[model samples]
Target: MTRIEQTFITLKQQNKKALIPYIMAGDPNPSVTVDLMHKLVAHGADIIEVGLPFSDPMADGQVIATAGERALAGGTSTRQAIEMVKQFRQTDQNTPVLVMGYLNPIEIIGYENFANLCSEAGVDGILMVDLPPNEADDFPKKLQHYTPCPMNQIFLLSPTTAFDRRQSVIDNASGFIYYVSVKGVTGSNALDTDDVSTHLKAIKANTDIPVCVGFGIRDGVSAKALSAVADGVIVGSELVRHFGDDSIDTKTAIDNILAKMDELRRAIDG
Candidate 1:
């Protein structure tokens, strides 16, 4: 099985909800970006989502969009992000690394080359927000030319999703289904756990593939709530806010997030 698939299996076996922490590559600088990754993994980041910078990220909110802008301004490129993955692969070939970003940068690098690089760099999956499942046959075909093993192309589903559409998306969803808890960006609001649970439970009952809920997940309480219904939880703005705070101890920030997520993770399965 692919690593992404294996990760879910392991998570299921352990009765633990995955803690996915997102980091925009080369934000601030490559070294810090790299350091932050290691720290996150050391803490409790079950899966690492490395975002590639794009000029215009429509699916993103102000935090992530601004993060992409900053990374791009700092010379972060599609190629550079892949290189960071390579660096990360040097030590961590086991933890699944997923590249999440816009399609324009991937187009610039060429799909096959980018996919090949990711496979070579030990990336386990891809999550292009703009790419829909209906047109994924082309990408799935083109992506075949590259990875050493199969690479899962993950997709997202929102609450407004209809049964037929959700079924189709779930049918096509590999690795895992990124179920958005709310209709907005990754952060900027408090997640209504009841709504998240109702949505995730329905999706879970419909498919065998694992479901991971994201957006507006800030603390362990939120993660714990989502965990009761979903297999995992993704945190984005919670992590990005750390990058902007120059005064807060980054180690502290990392620990705080770790503690919060860990608390929720434990509460779910404990």
Candidate 2:
């Protein structure tokens, strides 16, 4: 099984929900990305979603968009992001590392070449925000062909998604389904747990694949609320906001991020 599949299996057996944290590669600088990744695992991250810096990130909110800007300014490219994963794999062979980004960089690198690089870097999965399942024809095939284990193509399903589109995403998704909890962008504050629970019920009824909720989850209370219905909780903007602070040192930034992660982990495990 892929590392992602194995992780979900183990979590299911233990009756525990996954805690996935998102970090932009080279947020403050390229040197700290891998170390920050290891620190995230130490603090209680099950899966780490490393964001590849893009010129334009349409789905991200101001917090994450600013992070991407910092990353790009530090000279982090798509290849460099993959290299960070490779460095992270030196010690962390178990925790699944997913590369989350837009599709333009991959297009520039070419699908086959990007697949090969990801496979070599030991990337477990990929989440391209703009690539719909219907439009992704040969990319998934290339990933599967290049990797020793099948690389998962994680897809997003939002509340606004039509039934047919949701079905298509569910059918194509492998690692897990990223159920966007809110209708707005990544850091929007409009989270309603009751509505999330209702939508999750409809989604889980259709597929056995694990569904992880993301967006609008900020702290222990919200994480706890979402964990009741989701197989996993993904914290992005809430976590990324802790990094890239000019006033504080990188160590302090990571400490803040880990403190938040610890709270989320405790709440999820409770």
Candidate 3:
């Protein structure tokens, strides 16, 4: 089984929800990505989603978009992000590492080549925000051809998604379904837990695959509330915001990020 699948299965057995944290690879600099990933794992992150820097990230809010800009300015590329994952794999063989990004860079490198790179780098999953399941008929085949184990082709579902499209996404999804808790971009505020719970009921009725909620989750309260309904909680913008404060030193910035992670972990576990 893929690392992601194993993780969820293990968590289920433990009666615990997964805490998935996101970090922009090469944010501030390329050298810190691997270290930051390790720190995140140490701080109770079950899965790590590493953002590949892109010039245009439509789904991201201002916080994450600015992070991408910082990473791109530091000369971070798709290859660099993949290499960081390879470095991270040297010590962390258990925690699943997923690369989240747009499809432009993959297209530039060719899908087959990208699949090979991710497989060799020990990447567990890929979440291309713009690639719909209907349009990606051959992408999973390419990943399976290169990867010895199954590589998760993660997909997103939002409140605005039509039933037909939601079904198609769930049918094609492999690792887990990323349910956008709000109808806006990442980091937007005002999460309605009741609405999220209602939607999650409909989704869980259809599939046994783990469903993770993201977007608009900022703290332990929100994370804990969502954990009641979701198999996992994904925190991106709030965590990423801690990393982008230029005034703070890298060590201090990372400490702040881990502090936030710790808060979320405690709340979820409770």
lDDT of 1 by residue, 90-147 (tens): 8887888889987887887887777888888778889998888886776754453455
Worst ten-residue run, lDDT, model 2? 141-150
lDDT of 1: 0.79
Please provide, for model 2 over 81-101, each residue's C-alpha lDDT reduced to its tens digit, 9 standing for 90 to 100. Answer: 999999998998888999999
Give per-model TM-scores.
Answer: 0.91, 0.97, 0.97
Name model 3 segments beyond 4 Å from true: 141-145
Question: If ranked by TM-score, best first, what sequence of candidates would result?
Answer: 3, 2, 1
Candidate 1, poorest ten consecutive residues by summed lDDT: 140-149
Residue-level lDDT for 115 in candidate 1: 86
Give the Å shift of residue 54 in candidate 3.
Answer: 0.2
Error of 1 at 140 (Å): 3.4
Give each model's whole-structure lDDT. Answer: 0.79, 0.91, 0.91
Name every residue pair that clashes in candidate 3: none
**Cα RMSD for predicted model 3:** 1.1
